[model samples]
Target: MTAKVSYLISKPVVTINKGTHSIDAAKKMAEHNIGSLIIMDNEKLIGIITERDIIRALGKGISLDLPVEEIGTTKNLITINENDSIYKAAELMAKNNIRHLIVTNNDGKLVGIISIRDLIRESHVLKALSVTSEQEWIGSD
Candidate 1:
């Protein structure tokens, strides 16, 4: 059986206001132990800022004090529905070359976020279970 993205929505959504500075956004992410923050404007989802965006900013010599929206992944925000299958999520991530995906509900409301790490952890569990089942079958044969 395939797992739904909802099964991995264990954490609360960490968000930052759009006008927030890069340094502040980074601080929020660090404080929450998250890799990305949903950028909002007046309680509306506007974009997202990730560790990669901050690093890119540093590489370009951009001031960290600048608003995160200036460097956030805004133009083409990649997102997935919470009810989607994990396999679909993985395909979307690979297709877009993204490490994180914003998870929303059928109504398009923000729900949670999923990362490559999350998918890998789930995969490890599934692999272990499969191996254990195979071992049991072989032993019983």
Candidate 2:
């Protein structure tokens, strides 16, 4: 069976609104022990804020007091359908040179996200299952 990217999407996506301060976004990430947050405006998906984004902002001497919408990587955001295969998610990530992907439903509504880590973990699980099946088949011979 082909595993779907939806399987890796976590609910409620940990969002931050458009005008939130950059510092607050960093704090939210810290509080959630997560590396990223979905940026929203009036409940609409706008962009994404990640640990790297904050680190880059700070390194560039950007003020934390600025709105997260300004600091976030809002332009050219890459997204994927939640029902796509995990392999497709990984391929998209690779093609876009991104570590995270905003996941949407068939109606183009934000539902969740997929990350490189999720893909890695799923791949490991699939590899384990494949190895187990191979062992079983050999043992039956």
How many residue pairs clash (N, CA or C atoms closer than 3 angstroms) in each of the candidate models, in the order given? 0, 0
User: Which candidate has the highest lDDT of all?
Assistant: 1
lDDT of 1 by residue, 20-65 (tens): 8999999998998889999988867888999999999999999999
Deviation of model 2 at 38, angstroms: 0.7
lDDT of 2 by residue, 1-141 (tens): 778888997656899999999999999999988888999988789999988889999999999999988888889889888888787787788787888889999988889987788888886446755776899999998
Q: How much lDDT does each candidate structure score?
A: 0.87, 0.86
Candidate 1 — worst ten consecutive residues by lDDT sum? 123-132
RMSD of 2: 5.8
The positional error of residue 123 in candidate 1, measured at the CA in angstroms, is 2.8
Off by over 4 Å in 1: 124-141
Query: Model 1: how far is 1 from its true place, Å?
Result: 4.0
Q: In model 2, where do residues sit more than 4 Å from their true spots? A: 124-141
Question: Measured by TM-score, how close is model 2 to the native structure?
Answer: 0.84
TM-scores for candidates 1 onward, in order: 0.85, 0.84
Q: For every candidate structure, what is the RMSD over all alpha carbons to the true structure, in angstroms?
A: 5.7, 5.8
